[model samples]
Target chain A: MSTFLLILITGIGLGALYFLVASGLSLIYGLMGVLNFAHGAFLTIGAFTGLWIATKVFPNPTTWTFIFSMFAGGIAAGLFALLMEQLVITRLYNRHIDQALVTVGVSLVVTALLGGWFGFDARFLPTPLWFTKAATIGDAIIPVDRFIYIGVAAILLIAMLSILKFTRIGLIIRAGVENRSMVTALGINVRLAFSTVFFIGGFAAGVGGVLISVFSYGVSPLMGGSWLIYGFIVVVVGGMGSIAGSAIAAMLIGITNQFANYYVTGLGDFVVVIILAAVLLTKPTGLLGKVSH
Target chain B: MLRWKYSRPLLIAITVIFAILPFAGDNPLSKAGLQQTMAVAFLFGALALTYDLLFGFTGLLSFGHALYFASGMYVTAILINDFNVNFLLAILIAVIFTSLLAVLTGGAALRTTGITFAMVTLAFGQAGHVVIARDFGGFTNGDDGLPVNADRLPDFFIGVVNTKYLYLLALGILVFIYFTAWWITESSAGRVFAALRDNEQRVSVLGLNPNRFKLLSFVLSAAMAALIGAAMLIVSGSGSPRYAAADITIALLLMVILGGPVTRWGAVLGGIIYSVLSTRLTVLSDGTAFDSLPNFIGGPLAEPAFTLGLIFILIVMFAPGGISGAYYRARFKYLNKGK
Candidate 1:
């Protein structure tokens, strides 16, 4: 029973990380109608940036310094994404297939740059002193870092949902996603809304990267490629352009992967991929996705 | 097979060039390394040609075509190595098996279009990589790759050595694939594929099921890809897990783009040039001349794949139609001036 509780917590922690990543991807896909393959590269960039700051810029960094590093990472990713949007993606709007190919090219370039800059070896991030302890909940003991990740993810999720549901910008975004030309016709600056959404998406991916790096203790150039695949799976299974669906799908995949890892060992990644394919076969629209066409 | 009048002569010229390439190694016409490079290029040409059928002609951008290729190689390798199956029979089985796999996956994948289909296929490709690396490691030998014993292979196979005979075999298969692709494009069904590529909704409205033609193209493409895989195995004498991953698919995508999609001869030319240039570029990147450059500038440039990525972006951004399109436009302008 205690092991079950532990597994559940572990799954939720994993899910929270995925939720942070996939939600951003979902939002971008919803509004821009572009599958940003470089989303994972942003995560890698964020984590690496945070690590670089914590170690190189701030010697013997405290918990507060680490948090600041995370923010810097997110900001860096956001700026990079803004540039990508203004330069490359803006030209390829409405051409989804071409957009896919170009984004993949962007991803490769970013990944290669990271590899060249940082070298290919995976490096561990210096853990904040405060996160090294374990927290006991009921009869189950959980790492404090895991709990912190879940807490942070929950706060971000609430913030995103409230923004989307309550704010004028959120309404505009929702409307723009549904009918960009219609929104443009109605005199709403759909382009600005998309840019804002793209920035936020990049920001979320960066934060997710920081969080995952905090837990995993390192980052590599290739790390983003694997996560990008999983992020695609989550968004697809949850339903494209649906944040709620993506979150649910992320949790399901995260949990399944944990269980599969515990029981089946090496087949964990394979099982999740198979599940994604099965979901795609059975539910083309995804679990919570509205019929796109 | 459909003959696009102008390309017929070009195809014959390419065939003749490849036919003579192995013999030209000792002469000033070709370098010693040319034969091996062309052999691998022909295999890649076959792979790109099949991909062209799907993406360029049929309007289906599949990201998991590498899975079919790897499946073909592995099945044949396992049959010949482990089960002592006859080489010819194994090749036949590999083709049939991969096409059937393609049919099954394509049936499901065709339900989605554009990026959704690409992602679904990506998932399959990733899954295939994992399966080869882990689940079926016993047969695949995981990342180390499963090698075919030299003695087990028939007298025809070079068994890991890139030889004149292997080059001939690859060239022969490539010719077959080129002709097959050309014929498909010339067929009425091929016309339907072209129509589907232009506008699927309009074709469906005309009472033609786009999915049926998509499936046929998918199966045909997969069969050709698998044959290339078989040819690769015969040349390299091993099947590696990399064959089942997205890298090969992306490389083929790059080649197709370079050649210009929807142009069969362009894809072949793209494969040959990319294959040759990549090897040369890798050498240049690692050579002494690049060493004198500053670290920041030289670092990324030292990797040919990074340069390829840059070129891919440039092509997608500035010149979507690629070399073939440029040539056609120039020729058309010249002919118009003459008129």
Candidate 2:
């Protein structure tokens, strides 16, 4: 019973990170109508940025460093995405097939670039000195870092949702998703909305990087493919353009992965994909089914 | 002149030139270098045609259609290696099975269009890759790649020693398949697919159901990819789980975009250029300062993702229609503008 609980908690923790990543992807898809294939690469960039900060800047993964490093990573990733949009996304506007080709191409380029940047050999950063090594409850043992990831993800998610719901920028983004042309017609500068959404997406991914790397204990070039697929699965299964749906789908995918790892010994890696396929097959509109465009 | 574009003779001429060129040469060219490259190009062209039918015609971009290609390769391997079947029988079985798999998956995938469909397809493709990778004993041989015996092939047929026949066979199949795709693309159904690509709602309102057309395109595309997989196996003699994954799909997508998506010859040319530039250049060439630069730029750039980044940057910056598209676009403009 307790093992299940520990797993659930762990799943929720990583699930939170997945939510952040998927939400960014969902928003990008909702707004731009192109699947941002480079989103996972951005996550990796963010994580690597955090790692760089931890090692180069702070020498320890303290709370202060963790918080600041994530923001720094987010800024780098956001700027990177803005440049990509200006160059590639602008050309791809209204051409869905071309957009798909371009985005997939961009993903490959990003992955290739990151692979060169990080090298094929995976890299890691040590656990922060401040956080306790482990947490125990009865027969269950969980890493405190996992909980920290969950906390960080939760904090970021809440902050993002609030901004989306409450802010004028959020309203413009919401308006943009529904009618991009009208937003422009209103003299609202839809470009700014795009840039803001891009930044938010990149920022969420940046924070997700720190959370995810700690769980995996290392970061690798190969991580982008898996993460991209997972994020897509989450967004798709939850429905396309819904933030709430992303959260729900992330938890489902995350928990399913954790449990599948435990129960399905050999085919552990394939379960998420199979489950997602099944979901998509059964519910083509996905769980939320809100986004039509 | 208009009829000559997709005419059977032109395609036949192209195929025969490719087919005879291998045996026509001696020494260096005799070693099946260009032969293999053309074979692979035709094979990939066939795959890209399938992608174009899905992307160019039906207005779908299936990110994971390579699953069918991989499935065909693996199934062919299974027939030859496990069940001791002949190549023709194996390929036939692969095509049929791949079609069925496509129908089952495409039924679900075609329900969603654009990004959602891409994701759904990718999910299934990755699922297939993962299953193959994990199953060490039964299917995939756990990433070492499942093997097919050359001993199964007869003595006149390279004794498994000669890959030249395989190259010619691949070219033959490619020409055959390319014509098949060309015929379909020019057909009324193909027009419907094109309509769907331009505007699904308008097509539907015209009483042509977009979903049905999308489903049909997906199935046909899958079957074509399966055939390509058969050629891939014959040429390389093996199919890894890796070949059927998202990575290969990216390669095929790139092939299509580079070629100018809707054009029949363009796709083939794109595949040929990419295959020659990527495979033959690295595999057959004597190590030299000149050859090394392209490899260093495209090959030893080491890391699957970096090549993607470089290609994306280049395609977006300069070669928007891919190399073939860019070439053709420039030529047309030069000729017409000068006139």
Candidate 3:
């Protein structure tokens, strides 16, 4: 029973990271109608940024410092995404295949650049004092970091939901996702909305990257590629643009991956891929995603 | 019409150039190293041509086409090494096996369109990589890869090491694939493929089954990729799980896209140029020429994947039509000026 609890907690911790990454990917794909392959690169970029801030810029690290670094990472990714959108992605709208190719190129370039600047060596962020301790509940020991991950991810998820449900910008984004042409017809600058959403998505990805890096206690250049693939699977399985679906599917994936890894080594990713294929065959639109094709 | 006419003469000239490239060195038969490189280039050419068949003609952006190629490589390697099957027979069986695999996967993949198809293929391709690297370690040797030695082949051809024979074989296979691609593009079924590319709904309106034509192209492309993989086993004498990697598929796509997707000869040219540039650039970067530069600027820029990614971006942004498109426009302008 304790083992199951530990596994469940581990699953949630990882699922939170996936949710953070996939939400951005899903939102961007939903609104912009283009999947940013470089979304994963943003996470890597953010991880490096947060790591840099934590280590170099703020040497005297604390919980507040760590939190600040995560935001710095998100802001950095957001700014970069804004620049990339203006310079590259905005021009290729509606051209799906071209957009995909270009984004893939972006992903490759970003990954290479990261690999070049910071060698391929993995870097670990310093764990905060609060996270270094573990809480024991009924014979099951839960690390403080896992609880932190769950808490932060839950907050972000609720914040995103509230924004989407109640905020003006959120309403516009929702409208844009439903019908870009209709939003344009209504005199909304759809491009501006897209750019804004792109920034938010980038921010989310960056935050996720920082969180995952901290959770795992190591960050590497290749992390983005693997996470991006997982994020793609989550988004596709959850249904593109569906935040709730992404969260739910991410949990499913996280749990499955944990169980699979515990039972069978190296079979986790293969099972996820198989699940994706199955979803594509039966639910082309995803579990909660509207059928576009 | 004029473009097709021009393409024929142009293709012949390109073929002639490729046929003579190795012999242009000091001695006709002694340039084994160069011949080996060109053989690898031709193998890439075959890959690019097959990719163009799907992306250019059928309008399918498959991110996992390497699965088929890797299937052929692994199957051929296994048959030759484990089963003690004759090398030639293993290749034939590998091709048939991969074609059937393509049919099965393509059937399911074709049920979706555009991005979904791409995602599905990506998953399948990754699955291939995972399975090869893990589950089938007994058969595949996992991440370590399976090596084919000279003794694995028949006495007729000295395996992989005899660069001369491998070069000729690669060239012969490339030529065969080029013509096959040409014939497919000019056939009635090829017309349907083009129609599907232009407008799937319109093709359906015409009462043509788009899936049938797509599956045909997919299987053909997969079979051609398998043939290249078979040749790769002969040339490289090993099958790495890397063959099924997403990077390999991406590189092949870049080759086709850089050449102009719809143009068969262009894809061949793209393959040759891409292969040459990648090999040469990696060598140069690792050499002493760039050692004086600062690490920040020189280190990342010197990496081949970084350079290639930058080039890919530039092509996508400034020259989406690629080299062939540029070539066609230039020739059109030249001929029209005389008229």
Candidate 4:
């Protein structure tokens, strides 16, 4: 029973990370009709930048320093994403296929550049001591980092939901996701929304990157690629444009992965693939997906 | 620009030149080192041609092609090494198995079009990669990789002295694949494929099931990729987990785009050029030439992927039609000038 509880909590932590990456992917695909291959690059950049700050600026980081590094990572990644939109993605506006291809190119170049710069090895980040501590709840002793992940993820989710619910940009984005042509016809400058969506997605991915580094205790050039695949799966399973759907799907996949890995050894990844296939075959539109294309 | 009357002769001439390249005297072409490189180039060229059949002709942008290729490589290697099967029979069995696998996966993936299809295929491909890396049932041997057993009854295929046979074999595979792609593209089914690419709804209106044609193209492309995989195992003498990576499919995409999609030879050209550049760049990176340059500038230049990826982005931005598109444009302008 204790083991089950531990696995369940751990899986939620994993799911939290997935939601961070998937939220951005879902929003971008919803608004722009692009599968951003460079999203992984954004995550990688965030992770490396966070590492740089923790190691260089604050060799012995306090809680405040650590939080600052995380935000710094997110902001850097967000700016990079904005530049990508203004420079590369904007030029091929309306050409969804070319946009995807260019993103793929960007991902390759960024990953290669990171590998060249970082020497392709995993570098452990400096964390606050409390992050390494554990909390005892009943018979289940949970690592404090899991709570931090869950906490940060919950805050971000609420923040995003509120932004979507109340803001002007949020209204435009919601309408744009429904009918991009209609939104344009309404004269609301959908292009600005496009850049905004990319920035938000990049910021989420960057934060996710920092959290992932904390979870794994290190950062590597190729780390983002693996997580990005899961993010893609979550986006598809959760529906293309739905945040609530993504959160639910993320938890489902994460818990399933943990249980499968525990019960059958090397079957965790295989089971996740099975789930994806099942979902795709049964409901191609995903759990809450409205768009048929 | 060569007229239609001369294009056929020019093609034959090019083929003859490649066929006889191994005997071109003491230059780089005649050496064993270069022969191996060219053989790899030919293998990729064939693989790219198969990819072209899907993306260029049929408009299916699949991202999991490496799954089939890796299946062919690993299956053949396992059969030969573990079961002690003959190399030829192993390859034959691997091809058959991969075709069935392709049918199953392709059937499922073809249910979605465009980006969804790409993602579905990617999931399947990643599944294959994981399975291989995990060493399921101890068949794949995990990340250490599986090397081909040379004693399994093929003399000409083994040893450095007989690199020419491997070279010729690669050339033969490339030629066979080229003609097969050509035949398929020129057939009535190929016409339907072109139509499907342009407009799937119209193809359905014409009373042909677009899904079936797409499945056909998918299976054919996958099976051919598997064959290339088998050939690659023989050429390189081993199979590694990298064969199943998503990056391989991306590289194939790069080749198709670089050579100019829709034109079969353009894919082949892209494949050849990419393979050569990738191999040579590694050698260049390891050399002392970059030692004198600044770290920031030299570091990126040392990685071939950076340069290739930059070029890929530029091409997608500027030259949507690739090298073949450029050639066609120049030819059109020259002919109009003559008038």
* Candidate closer to the true structure by lDDT (higher is better), 2 or 4: 4
For residues B51-169, write the lDDT of model 1, one tens digit per residue.
Answer: 99999999888899999999999999999988999887998999999999999888988888877798889988898899898845578888898887678766756533347778888
**lDDT scores in order:** 0.83, 0.76, 0.86, 0.89
Candidate 3: tens digits of C-alpha lDDT, residues B1-339: 437566668877977776766556656444776677778888998899999999988999998999999999999999988899988899999999999999999998889887789889999999999999894557999989888756978654573346777787898899999899989999999999999999999999999888999999999999999999989988877899889998888888889878888988779888888887787667787797668888887777777778888888888888887899888888788778957
Q: Is the docking of candidate 1 incorrect, acceptable, medium or high quality?
A: medium
Poorly placed runs, candidate 2 (over 4 Å): A60-63, A129-132, A266-269, A281-283, B1-14, B25-28, B32-38, B156-161, B201-207, B280-320, B323-339
Pairs clashing in candidate 3? none
Model 2 lDDT tens row, B173-282: 77688778978888998888888888889988888777888888889989988988977887877788788778788777777777767777767776666666666444
lDDT of 3 by residue, A1-293 (tens): 88888888888888889998999889888887787888988998889999999999998789899999899989998888888889888787677677778888888888877877888888988756777788887899988788777787788899888888898888998887777778889898778778888888889889888998977778898888889988999999999888898999899888888888878888888888899999889989988995373
What DockQ results do all the predictions give, each relative to the true complex? 0.66, 0.46, 0.74, 0.73
**Which regions of candidate 1 fall more than 4 Å away from where they truly are?**
A291-293, B1-7, B25-34, B159-162
Expressed as tens digits, the lDDT of each residue in B229-269 for candidate 4 is: 99999999999989998889999999998889998988999
Give the true-contact fraction for every prediction, in order: 0.60, 0.60, 0.72, 0.64
Q: Which residue ranges in model 3 land beyond 4 Å of their true spot?
A: A129-133, A291-293, B4-10, B13-17, B20-33, B155-161
Q: Which residue pairs clash within candidate 1?
A: B1-B183, B2-B186
Model 1 residue A72 CA deviation in Å: 1.0
Chain A of candidate 2: what's the TM-score? 0.92
Please say which candidate is ahead in lDDT: 1 or 3.
3
Winner on lDDT (1 vs 2) = 1
Candidate 1 per-residue C-alpha lDDT over A92-209 given as tens digits, one digit per residue, 9 for 90 to 100: 8777767777877888888877776777788878866878888788888877887877787788788888988999999998887677778889898888887888788888888888
Q: Give each model a TM-score.
A: 0.95, 0.89, 0.95, 0.98
**In terms of lDDT, which candidate is strongest?**
4
Instruction: Assess chain B of each prediction and give its TM-score.
Output: 0.93, 0.86, 0.93, 0.97
Q: Model 4, clash count?
A: 0
